[model samples]
Target: MDKQTSRNLWRITAGQRLRYASAIAVTGLASAFMLSVPLVGGYVLDVVDTQDLAQGAALLVEAANTLAVEIGGKPYVAYLVLSAVAGVGLTALGATCQYLQGRWAAIASEALARRLRETMYERMQHLPASFFDEADTGDLVQRCSSDVETVRVFLSSQVVQIGRSILLLSVLTPILFARDARLASLALVLMPFIIAGAYYFFAKVREQFKITDESEGALTARLQENLTGIRVVRAFARQAYEVEHFGSKSLALRDNRERLNRLSGAYWAVSDFLCTAQVCIVLIAGGMFLAAGSLSVGELFAFMMQVTMVIWPVRHLGQVLNESGKAMVSLGRINHVLLAEEESRDPAPATERVRGELVLENVTVEYEPDRPVLKDLSVHIPAGETVGIVGPPGAGKSTLIRLLARLYEPQHGRILIDGLDLLEVDRHWLRRQLGIVMQDPFLYSRTVADNLRVARADVNDTEMMAAAREAAVHDAIVGFPAGYRSRVGERGVTLSGGQRQRLALARALLVEPPILVLDDALSAVDTGTEGQIMAALERRRGRHTTIIIAHRLSSVRGADRILVLEQGRLIQEGTHATLAATSGPYRRLCEIQGALDEAIERDLKETSNAV
Candidate 1:
């Protein structure tokens, strides 16, 4: 694996320290059992050489004979009873041990996965909105789902199983040497060559697997983007284009997999051939020793059995190497997400109520240093005063409001609330004092009541209904099949444009903050409804400091003061009537709206005459 990916794998696996050790113990025990079997068989063979071969045979016969006579000549029945009892007991013990080991492995894998996801989510929550702008949603989903599953599978399936195999090899190899030094030494000569080949293959496999994982993540991202923007795609007739893009990503992933498989296959085939050659040499040498009277028939039989036990675990040594490579791949994918930079915020303190005077002093924002969105702009909103902000497209109106909310910090100057610099204050405390209603509001896929509750969870049903009534959405909500409990569907798609706008207004009202911002919030409503909402806002004008950004003159007509912007600079500031009387950009906007209204009236008259 690449160094960066290797480091990430090490970090994630490090969290499973205890379970890893337990896994080692369980695997070791299993390996030991496999290695011990041949030695036990050898011991039985030794008894034939030392004691009378007939006596050795007679022990089994005698036990059978005694049981048969006791049961009226059933020799087969006697043997069955003896073998069944021993087999059942041994099987139960082995099964119990294996089950516990499996459970430990599962616990380790799940626990590690949970911790990794939690850490990633915590980071995501803190990261700035800009981070989401730069990142792909589908790639994030893949990291949490398929990539995580890959890591879990390695832990439960490959890592622990490979450990067991190695343990068995270690236990069996020594026994073979102790039985006969010459034969044992001969078998071990092939070990270094096998180990070297395994490591070389492991390096290649790790690289290929990492590429495969990245390609898969990219494919997921492409599919998700296509589905989410399917409307645009169909409108443009780009179905074939999307399919081709998705197909390319999939093909890349498949090629990586095939490459890894080829490398793994080569390693296994070589290891298998070497093992077969080793076994043949052992059998030929053992036969010669027996013929020369240097080894008895029983001794030769035992040696052969021990040699048979050693091959699987020796092969397992290579398998373990393979598993390690895959684990490394999964670890890298998860780590990349964990390492991505998170959003920055000031540490919060205990609750502190805000006195709503907002000040922006010579503030400037440059997304890139040479190109400033807002340049040395300064403005103030007095407590309990309502101000309207009127600006043309790309006039930095939205950027100004965002800075006041501390969603984006000004790079060149400071923003203050009640004369204190905003940077020094806690983020949560600052947010508690401000409420924003955007042009396009966000709603959860939940009930109307639940969405309102997000602003203030302790709000009662009576208070909730009151907010809805003030926003003029109460009657429509009550008419729904489930009333306030009706599901809004994803992003409140079930609600009409006007209804959704009012629901968002209701939600903002529930927060009850000292400062309120309305950024073209009433744009979706009819003129009559807009007038009614403005009248309600005017009644509470002196109770809260309100900032409204609008292009429509009628919406901002009731404000105490209006600020007009051109390009990214504030060009005019006064009451609506005062600004309208003076020839400027604000007057031009009013003229545009008047002409549009007159054109609509003429169209309606022409349609009536034709009818």
Candidate 2:
């Protein structure tokens, strides 16, 4: 892992690191008891040996005499029983220690995962809107959930096992050498090979696991997109195309995972072979030593057991390297998100209440470098004035409103709200004062009343009903079987597009912000409903500033002033009648809309006569 990634991991889990250390310490004690088991069993075998029965076992007789002198003439059988009980007791003690180590490790690792997840999620919430525009939701979800779980597994299992294995090897190696240096050297002859193999495996496995992780993230993104847009796919009759696209990503993930698993399997197979060979070499060499009187049977047996302890951990070390390699890759991916720059906001307190006097002086914005959406645009709306903005498609209408709402900062010039620089204002405070209903409004799966009150949780039922009445959706809401308590499906799928838009408008109005911007919010509603909503808005004209961006000329005809824009430039500004009388873009748009409306009316009348 890189330094920053390691730092991030430690920063999140600093409180739990001590617990992890304690768990490792306990594991070491458990390993000590485990190592003693073989030595103790070897001693028991020596004591129980009955070769040359006529002579009566010398080792057993000696042990029995010692025990009898120490304990009121108890027989050797009593000594044997005590030795068996001691072995069992040691085993039980070791098991208890192992359990404690596992429990503590689990606690530490799980807590680390939880902390990391919470931090990542909180960071995501504060990220700028542009980040979400470019980021894949599925990939982010994968990082927050699956990737963190992978790290948890590494911390809980691989890390603990690695420490245990190293401790066992360190403690047992000297004992093996003390028993017989020549045999010990042979037992560890494969150490260099194991180290070299581990290094090679770490390098190769880390890269392979990175590829697998990225592939999985991409596959998840594709699946999420397909599911979220299932309606669009069906409407376009593109099920086959979507399925093929999804299948390709799925297969790529599978192939990468298979390759990673193959690499892991090959490494372990080689490691196991090397460890087994070392054990076999020690057994053969010790047998020869025993026959030559250089080693006793019991001693040789203990030496062989100790050699196994030293070599088996090498295999486990290989597995740890493999798992930890994957975890490091996951950690790196997570760090990328955690280290991303969050949305910048002024630290100064917002002591001024917004009066909704907005001014844009030569404002310019671009989603991409050198591709300006709005260029050198200037406009002003005094407090308590209702301004209508009309523009052609791609004329930066939405961009202009977004700038006023402080959702995006302009690359050039400045925006001022009540004579204060918009950039200097606290973002949260500014947003709370501006109520916006976009062309595409999002609704949660909730009741009508709940959706209406989302912008202002403190709003009472009467306030919600009043806002719903202003949006001309009150009757529609109460007409439902369960009234305001009825559930709207995901994204308001159960409601019509027009109904969803009106509910969004109601939600914005319920907050009663000092500034309200409707970016084609009433486009989905019928002309009758739109008229009712506009009339209701007129009643609150001087109470707050309102900016309406609409394609329908009728929606803005009664505005205090209408601004016509084309190609991100304000081409005309006047009352609707004055703009209609002039020979300009506004006049042209009015003429075109008139012709379209006449044609629609004629068609409807002809259809009625035929019926």
Candidate 3:
């Protein structure tokens, strides 16, 4: 891993590095204890075959003499039994260490995965709106889930195996040379080639892993979109087309995955061949040393056993290096989200409630360069005044409210809420002070009461119902199978379009924000129902600063002042009576809507008369 990647991993592994450190120590201890088994076997063979306790090294001779009690057919029998016990005991201790190593690795990896998930979720919550606008929901979900799993697998398995490979080499190489330096050199001649080949394969496959990850992400993103819009797909009878598109994404993912697997297969094949060749070379050379009477058969056996230990780990490392590449790529993808700049947060969020006085001075905004959405727009709505904003589509109506909520900063001028710059006030605090209901509002797949209570934690049942009643959605909610306990299915599909909007409106009202914005939020309701909700809002007059953005003039006909927008500029501003009497966009819209309504009314009457 590079220094930056290692640093990111260390940062994420906070509070759990000690556990990993312990696992590493345990792995080393396990390797040392387990490696002693071959030596014990070699020592017993030497003593039994030669029928002398002094045939092998002086250390074993002295230890065997001390450990063995004579209850023997031959002198070495008691020593043989003692050797069995020693070998079993060492193996058991090593196994125990192995178990501890696995447990610690698992615990640490799980903790890291949990922390990764929580950090991603919290950071996403604070990320600026533009991040979501440019990010795919499915790709982000995969990063949080699949990418975390990839890293977890690496942490739990590959990380410890890597430490084991290093320990095996560092500890065993010295022992091999100590036993017989000349033979040990021959045994290790092919080992460097194995490691070099593993890394060379690693370098080749890293880019392929990244490509496979991207393909999988794209597949999931397309799948998520199709599932979310299943209704739309079925409504348009586009199942075949959608299925074909999904198949293509799946095929791309499959092809990329197969390519990655091919590369892995080639690595394993070459590494396996190299490992076998090294083992054969060590054995052939040990036989030559034995023929020259310099190497004992028992010692040769021990050398073969230890060389196997070293050779297998070299191959094991090749497999782990592949996992390391994927883990590194996943870490990079996840870190991107964790490092992206979050929405602005004030060190000390404004604690005082805003008076809702809003001022826009020569405010210019643009989503794209040189193409302003709201151009030099200036307006002021004092506290407790009811204002209406109306414009055709793409006239910057929604942009204006978002600016007031501080979702986006103005490029040319500043917005003030109660004499404080929008940027100066905390973004979270400003949003809480403004209750906004969009045209197609979203509802959670939860109980009606839960969704309503989500807006204000302190809102009791009584307050919730009152707000719902004001939005004219209380009766509909009560009519559900379980009343307030009834669950609204995903995105509120259980309710009509108008109910979703009104329920969202009720949620906003529960906040009792000083600034209430209804951005064409009543388009789905009939005029009669809109009138009932508007009448309820009327009772709130002079108590809240209300701005209603509506395409239907009737929704905003009674406001104190109406502002009409054309393109990105404010072209007209007045009350209903004043604007209607004048010839401008407002009057032209009223005339066009009036003629359409008359035509619809006549058609209905003629059809009823014929019946």
- Top of the candidates by lDDT: 3
Q: Write the per-residue lDDT of candidate 3 for residues 1-611, one digit (tens) a residue.
A: 79999999889888988988899899999988888899889988887777778765565555556655333244466567667888899899999999999999999999999999999999998998789989899999889999999999999988889989988989899989999898789888988899999998897788899999988899889989988899999999999999999999999999999999999999999999999999999889899989999988789988899989988998999889988999999999999999999887875344567778999999999999999999999999999889999989999999998888777889999988888888887777788788999999999999999889889978899999999999999999999999999999998889999999999999999998999999999999998889999999999997789999999999999899999998889999999999999999999999999999999999999999999
Model 2 scores what on Cα lDDT? 0.85
How many backbone collisions does model 2 have? 0
All candidates: TM-score: 0.86, 0.95, 0.97
Location of the lowest summed lDDT over 10 successive residues in candidate 3: 66-75
Per-residue lDDT over 1-611 for candidate 2, one digit per residue giving the tens place of the 0 to 100 score: 56866676668678988888889999998888878877766665655563322222355456666778888765656556655776788889999999999999999999889989998999987787778888899999889988999999998878889888888888888888887899989988988898788878988999999999998899889988888789999999999999898899989989998999889888988888888888888889888998898876667777887788788887788788888889989998898788888878776445546788989899889988988888898888999999999999998999887787677899999998888888987788788778999888999999877787688889888988899899998899999999999998888988988999999999999878899999999889899999999999999988889999999998899899998888777889999999999998899999999999999999999999999
Off by over 4 Å in 3: 56-73, 347-351
Runs in model 1 lying further than 4 Å from the true structure: 1-16, 45-92, 162-172, 234-241, 263-267, 270-311, 349-351
lDDT per residue (tens digit) for residues 312-352 in model 1:
46676677777678777777667766777654556664547
For model 1 the local lDDT of residue 276 reads 77
Candidate closer to the true structure by lDDT (higher is better), 1 or 2? 2
Which candidate has the top score in TM-score? 3
Q: What's the CA error at residue 197 for candidate 2, in Å?
A: 1.4
